[model samples]
Target: GIQVEQSPPDLILQEGANSTLRCNFSDSVNNLQWFHQNPWGQLINLFYIPSGTKQNGRLSATTVATERYSLLYISSSQTTDSGVYFCAVTPMDSNYQLIWGAGTKLIIKP
Candidate 1:
């Protein structure tokens, strides 16, 4: 079993601001993903980055397998970005199952 921890349980950002969310895992992992949970509790996949960096529009993510940590960066935050962000991971030997962290709640102010 693996352990996951997310930083800044809560965050507040002004519209158009940039913010970074961090996730740390206790052990080595093979699969890693970042998700954004909307108000309706629907989880939207942001990235499936086990290592390196990827960017999509105003959102980006980077994972360092050696360091056992990952980061989600939001550029020019919008009101729609206000929600909980989660990081999930799975071991390489496992069946790609995921272990979730508590999540970081983001609030975008006008």
Candidate 2:
């Protein structure tokens, strides 16, 4: 089994600010996914980083299976980025049931 935890339960940033969100895990994982839950509660997949780093626009993510942790970096934050970010992981042999962290709620003030 894998355990996940997110840092900074809440975050406040200016519209153009940059922030790094972290996720720590207790064991090795084969699959990892980052999600953003909008104000309307719709979960949007941000990234599926099992290893290495990937970027999309102002958002980027990196996952290290050996260290059992991952990070989500947001550059030039926007009001639309205000939401709950969640990190989920699946064990190497499991059925892909994601174990989710509590989440980091981000607020980008305009």
Candidate 3:
């Protein structure tokens, strides 16, 4: 089983600001994903980086399997970015179910 934990349980930012979110795991994992849960409750997959760095517009993520942690970076924040960010993982063993973090709530105020 893999345990997931996210730092800065909550965040508040102004437009154009930058922020970083972190995720730590208790065990080695074969699959990892980052998602943004919108106010409407839709989950948008931001990254599927099992062990690498990826960028998409104002968002980027990096995962280090050796250290058992991952990071999600949000640059030039905006009101549209307000939502809950979640880190989920599936262990190397196929028998385990996906483990999800408590989620980090982000708010970008005007």
Candidate 4:
């Protein structure tokens, strides 16, 4: 079983600021996804990168399986970005079970 951990358990930022969130795993992973839980509790998939870097608009993510860690970056943050960011991973030995981190709570102020 793999253990997932997200850093900076909580974060607060003003609009237009940039922030970085991190996730660390205790073992190798074959599938990794980043998700956002909005204020209404709807979960949105942000990234599905198991390795390497990928970007979408003002958001980007990088995962290094060898190092057992991943990072999510948010640039020019907005109030809409206020939510809980989660890191979910499927270990190399597992097929469908996803281990999820406690999540990083982000609050963006106007």
Q: Tell me, by TM-score, which candidate is best.
A: 4
By descending lDDT, how would the candidates be arranged? 4, 1, 3, 2
Candidate 4 wrongly placed segments (more than 4 Å): none
Total backbone collisions for each predicted model:
0, 0, 0, 0
Among the numbered candidates, top lDDT falls to 4
Q: In angstroms, how far off is 11's CA in candidate 2?
A: 0.4
Question: 5-86, model 4: which lDDT tens digit per residue?
Answer: 9999999999999999999999988999999999999999999999999999999999998999999999999999999999
Off by over 4 Å in 3: none
Candidate 2 achieves a global lDDT of 0.94
Query: Would you list the C-alpha lDDT of every candidate in the order shown?
Result: 0.95, 0.94, 0.95, 0.97
- Cα lDDT tens digits, model 1, 1-110, are 79999998999989999999999999999899999999999999999999999999999999999999999999999999999999999976798589999999999999
What tens digits encode model 3's per-residue C-alpha lDDT throughout 59-98? 9999999999999999999999999999999988775678
Worst 10 residues of 3 by lDDT: 90-99
lDDT of 2 by residue, 37-88 (tens): 9999999999999999999999999998788889999999999999999999
Record all residue pairs in model 2 with backbone atoms less than 3 Å apart, i.e. clashing: none
